[model samples]
Target chain A: MSTADRKARDKENLKALILQGAKKLFLEKGIEQTTIRNIADEIDYSVGTVYVYFKDKNAILHDIHTIGFQELGGSFTELFTIEDPMDRLRKMGIFYMKFAIENSEMYDLMFNVKAPMEFIEHSEKEEWNEGVGTFNALKNTVAQCMEKGHFKGHSLEPLSFMIWGVVHGMCCLEIRQRTKGVKFSKPETILMDGYHEFLKIIEKL
Target chain B: MSTADRKARDKENLKALILQGAKKLFLEKGIEQTTIRNIADEIDYSVGTVYVYFKDKNAILHDIHTIGFQELGGSFTELFTIEDPMDRLRKMGIFYMKFAIENSEMYDLMFNVKAPMEFIEHSEKEEWNEGVGTFNALKNTVAQCMEKGHFKGHSLEPLSFMIWGVVHGMCCLEIRQRTKGVKFSKPETILMDGYHEFLKIIEKL
Candidate 1:
């Protein structure tokens, strides 16, 4: 390989390593506590070298967001492989909730807090889109499910938005440590039941 | 009334007024910008009076939370007069959204950020039982509906939590201002569609 190609690969690897270290620190210590110096230290690199890749602290956070979204888009990719359109739609919702429950901070990055608009506004850079935004994937599934004669009562976009609303809302409450008062044995079970509720309505449609 | 009773009532009213002013200002300028001194200035009271009632900035936040929980709980009092369980559940969810929509700041206070968990752990506070906490009234309605042979399968708490998940998930995404890339014509319509899906499982149950 050419020297330039090797250097590019090396830079990419370092970026990923930095992101990995940053995500860990941010989740454990919170965004305020995770410093560039700390991330550089974690990766056994100098702070100046870290600055070479990222312009500033927010830039680091933006990269962390990009890394998170790329992985998240991959997570929702499971919906594309399933054949039964109806089942795919159901699984998509389940996967969405499952993703939120598993990688909470990442989920927060994707949908909970504001994403600096640059990331959401198309200036997000190529690495951020993965296979298009996960929202599009979710929308396509909903549209396909609608075409197959499931969920006829609502328009595609709104329907998908509502589905996300319920899922995110429940998970947000659970994550916020407020669910203790709600008296649920498990939050997932509720999600499943709610999913079934939606399934029932769609079948009727 | 007696002079002592009048003084006590005036003190309570002034404290409430200060709290309301603080909440309004905090949302306008953020938690950091809204200060005790500023709050007192808004109400034309001395900073000393503000400190007499509140130990610190966090105390004012605590009182605002107390008031917010009461307002959130009170939203249901008008609905309980309706006897139809299914409609009540539907309205409860809709009202949940409306509450979040109308009282944006209070909604932020209730679930978006962490509050001082002073009154929630102990049951002595008013609105602690029945329908005070956001989960209580919703769960109570859900339990009643389940008992009436309306919806089946899942337990009420999890179902309630799931319902909340989707509702808040949608709201959170929108309210947090990160839906720039997300394409949805009618955001609420997309979100509430989860309810129909929810009812499907309920019917089978």
Candidate 2:
């Protein structure tokens, strides 16, 4: 490769390294407790090097959050091959739930954490394209289900939002430790069990 | 009143005053930003006096969360009088959504915030009686619905939890500003509109 091309690639690789370190610290110590210095130490880079890639913690949080959406999208890539919208919708929820459960810290950062949204507020482009894109995936699937004559009496947007709420709610409760405190009969399996109940209801719908 | 009785009443009133002030600061400046000193200043009490009432911020958070449950129960009182379990369950969700949206801060403390749960972990009892009581209310209503031949093939606990998740997910998303970030067609009414979709699905079930 040419020297200029190699330099550009090196810069991109360094930026990715900083983001990876930031994500690790966010998971281990929590987003609120993790700082730029922590990220710098995690990657064996100077604090100045970390700052060269991102303006501040919020900028790092925003980038990590964006990466989370990309990872989630990558996970959903296989579902696109399914022909039936109804079948795809059911599996979409399962994928969403599994992703949330397995990568909870990242999921929390993507959906629940305020820093990324706060970052968006201060940035010139205020739209949350990551969230909008994810929501639209669900909305589009629901729209297809409607075309196939499911969701008979439901409005599209509200119905899609309701479905999103169901899965997000289950995942949020589990991740936040609310499920364990409630002492469900099947504490370990309540997230999936509750989700199955939703699947049953939606199948009939 | 006798001197002893007057002293006891005054103490209770002062404790309530402190909690009210803390909640106000929690709402205005956020829970993390509001210190014990802020609470004391808000109520015109000394920091030591506030300490005399509660050990730390967690203690205050735990107590406020208990009060939030009580307020929720108070809001639920009228629903209990409905003869039909299905009707009562429908209205119960409505009441829950209303309480969550109207008192977003308190609702976050009751369900989402980690401080109260952390306090419970360190306390002697370690049982979340408040969460248990609230869940039992929903469980009993769902039990009634099952007895009436509604929810014919669903397990009681998971189904109840799913119902809880539905409302909670919508409220959490809205409270955490996820709803607005997604750019919903009707951001203002999405919570209720999403809830209405849930009501429709359960009605069929």
Candidate 3:
């Protein structure tokens, strides 16, 4: 490879290394508690080198947020194999729930935290590509389901948004500790149980 | 009234006054932005007196969290006039959404913020009374719906929790600006439209 191409690849690799370190710290101490210095320390790099790759903490958070979505998408690879749209949608929710429960801190950064979003707002892009991309996957699945004569009489976008809300809301409530306040009979499995309840209702539709 | 009764009444009134001032400040600024000193200044009470009424910021937060629920409950009073359980449940979701949209900050405190839950965690109660009470209201309405031959074959608690997740998740996304990120077609009415989609699904059930 040319020198310029090799340098470009090395730069990308280092950027990934920095983000991996940042995510590790964030998962350990939460996004609020983790700092750029901590990330540098975790990655065994100088703070100045970290700054060379990211403008600030928000930049790192935004990148990590993107990675989180990518991970969530990666978890969905098995869903596409399910032929029936309805069945695919069901498995998708289960996979979505599993991703959220397992990677809760990453999930919170993607959905709940304000930093990554604030970074988007201040930056030039002015659109949440990660969110839109993930949302489209669900929207597409739901649209397919609609074509199969399920979810009748429902508008596509809103119906997609509603499905997103059902799963996301459960995860948000669970991660934010709102579910604990309510004291469900099965606190541990309530999320899956709640999704099952939703599944039964949607199956009728 | 006896002198002792008058003294107790005055104490209650002052406590209410403090909460009123705190709520106004919270609405004007935000919970994090509004401090104990700001609250005292707003109410023209000394910081020590504020302490006399509330043990700390969490105590004040816990009390305001209760008031937020009380206000939410007050909005639900109209639901009782509806005779049909399914219809009431629908209206309840609508009213719940309305409350979340209109009282976004207060709703965040009651549902999403950690202070109130942390207060519950550190305190002796060990149970979330306000959350349990509010959830019980929803659970009761859902149970009535099942008794009336609606929602066949669904467990009561999980069903109620899922319903809660649907509404809460919508509000959580909207308030947290996730809806803005997704760029919904009707950004302004996505929450209600989403609920309508949910309403369509449940109507079949």
Go through the candidates in order and give the clash count of each. 23, 0, 0
Candidate 1 lDDT over A159-188, as tens digits, reads 666666666676677666566544556644
As for candidate 3, its clashing pairs are: none
lDDT for each candidate structure: 0.68, 0.91, 0.91
lDDT tens digits by residue: candidate 3, A72-178: 98988878888898999999999999999899999998998887888999999879999999899999998999899987788999989998999999999999898
- Tens digit per residue, CA lDDT, model 3, B1-205: 6999999999999999999999999999988899889999998998899989887899899899999999999999988898898999999999999999999999999988878998888889888888898888889999999999988889999999999999999999999889999898899889999999898888877
- Model 1: runs farther than 4 Å from truth? A1-18, A40-56, A118-132, A185-205, B1-18, B32-59, B117-132, B147-149, B152-154, B186-205
True contacts kept of each: 0.60, 0.69, 0.78
TM-score of each: 0.77, 0.93, 0.91
Local accuracy of candidate 2 as per-residue lDDT tens digits, A1-205: 6999999999999999999888888888888788788889888999999878887888999999999999999999999999999999999999999999999989999988888898898899769999999999999999999999999999999999999999999899888878878888779889889999998998887
What is the alpha-carbon lDDT for the whole of candidate 2?
A: 0.91
Q: Pick the candidate with the highest TM-score.
A: 2
Docking class of 2: medium
Which of 1 and 2 is ahead in TM-score?
Answer: 2
> For candidate 1, what is the lDDT?
0.68
